[model samples]
Target: MLSLILIGGSIFASCRKQIAVQSIPNMPVNYTIYDNSAQAIKLAKEGMLSITNVEVENTAIGYGGLLVVSRTITPSAEDLAYDLSCPYEVKQDVRVRPSKDNSFAVRCPVCGSVFNVAENGGAPIAGPAASSNSPRRMRQYRVIRQPDGIRIIN
Candidate 1:
């Protein structure tokens, strides 16, 4: 009986879901965007932006510079930010871009993975990303609402 129980436990452990573990750049990220500005206003209306090749002070962390994909749920009220690099590829240059059809999805041109950014956190809806066994969602950052603007922290 003891041997059977041990075998069953081992089987269950082996069958457990595998989490994708990737190296994340550990640097301080403090980005701010003020409301009532032209860029902010436009972002409010569109609700999304594909920021690429941002030059942060520390290039050692996060793919060369900072590549971020941002979205606003309330359009000037709430902001959400995520790293744009595709988890499938660990490099920083492989970033995701917004779909051309105005869909709420971002596609990785490298691997042809489409992630639905319109929902809460960036979720893989289709393509090779959807089939990934680990690191399912895009890496997300912290967005905080401030009195004047919004602040993103990494």
Candidate 2:
């Protein structure tokens, strides 16, 4: 009887789930948008990137409430990726704000959940975050460079 109880307890513990957010997979797609790298850096430095373009932002909201922004790094001009999804909940209403460390992150005003953008921008850092699930992963939009302009799509 004692051995059976121990075995059962171990099994239960082992079966516990891990809570983490996940994002859509990144695939090769074409996006026709402004390739102004300076604007991206400006937004990063400002600690906030608003969606002035309703069409673009709405498209993201339509597709799983997420959008990927691709920026071209200077000198190397390497591409950097980001998602517009709120890591706390699957809601398009949430907006990203800068963390105390000056990093781009999202804060769900409704739930007060903070998500860190530095680590892919989908993992909850503090407040009412899932403690059990897979490791939080954000969806990435594949960015392709074209001679005419930069293509960003997922």
Candidate 3:
């Protein structure tokens, strides 16, 4: 019985998907958006934004700016925030923006890679950026819901 349990645990652990470790810098993320504000409401509805050239103390990591993506998974009404940096190219400025069609995918204009932000934790669904050897996913940040707003944190 003990061996059977151990083998079962090992099989389950081995079946788990491997998470990609990106090279992007881990800078402090402390920003809030009021729920009633236009920006916040728009983000909640649209689910994506190309926040260009944001001023942050750690300019080294996000020199180009930051991209923000929001999604409301089923079973939880709260919106989740994800960093829009392309995992393939880890730089402060290399970020992804929403497609013109407003689909679930975000495209990296620099690399021509389009990632599906709403699926599989921002996995690279298509484009020139998809490589088997590369970390092909978007970095995510922590988002906490408040009574009046949502807080983004790294």
Candidate 4:
């Protein structure tokens, strides 16, 4: 009984650890990109976009906006979507910009933290995001793939 309890506790703790990203100010988000849209085309080609299409759906885009990435045309899983806000900064204005050279990683101009995007899990890979005593990953939103479009919500 003790062993089983210990195992369960360990599992829960690990899950918590994975979720220990710093919090950004709360902002509701509900955005969609239709299949025929330019954003969709870019995603299908494994390109990334920093989207701030506010008022499109009467919803806030995200804390600092949205960073959407696609790894495949017809991905088996979700197309990655994350809040542009730097988790290390935890402010709506402090956004992470994707590196011009690397489409799969973004760097915070303020904190110099780099995060892996797309299929890479949005985890901090370098700089303060990784080197901080309490390291944090990027804040991700749910990417729901639909027949007509991709709906991202937070």
Candidates' TM-scores? 0.71, 0.55, 0.69, 0.77
TM-score: the better of candidates 1 and 2: 1
Tell me which of candidates 1 and 2 scores higher on lDDT: 1
Candidate maximizing lDDT: 4
| Model 2, span 72-99: residue lDDT tens | 2122333434455444455545544445
List the candidate 4 regions with Cα displacement exceeding 4 Å: 1-19, 73-77
Q: What is the lDDT of residue 9 in candidate 1?
A: 100
- The Cα error of candidate 1 at residue 31, in Å, is 0.7
Per-candidate alpha-carbon RMSD to the true structure: 4.0, 5.5, 5.8, 5.2
CA lDDT of each candidate? 0.64, 0.49, 0.64, 0.79
Per-residue lDDT tens digits for candidate 4, residues 1-154, read 9999999999997777444455666678789889999888877775677886585657668788998887462144558788998998888778898787676788999989888885555788888888876778887888888999988997
Give model 3's TM-score versus the native structure.
Answer: 0.69
lDDT of 3 by residue, 1-154 (tens): 9999999999998888755555556665666667787767778677665555444453322333445556552124445556657666666567777888547777787877777666566677776556554546776666687899877776
**What would the per-residue lDDT of candidate 1 be over residues 56-134, giving only the tens digit for each residue?**
4532223423333344443334466777787666567878887886457778888887776666467777776678666
Instruction: Give the least accurate 10-residue stretch of model 1, judged by summed lDDT.
Output: 59-68
Model 4 residue 17 distance off true place after TM-score fit, in angstroms: 6.9
What is the TM-score ranking, best to worst?
4, 1, 3, 2
- Candidate 4 at 47: error in angstroms? 1.5
The positional error of residue 36 in candidate 1, measured at the CA in angstroms, is: 2.6
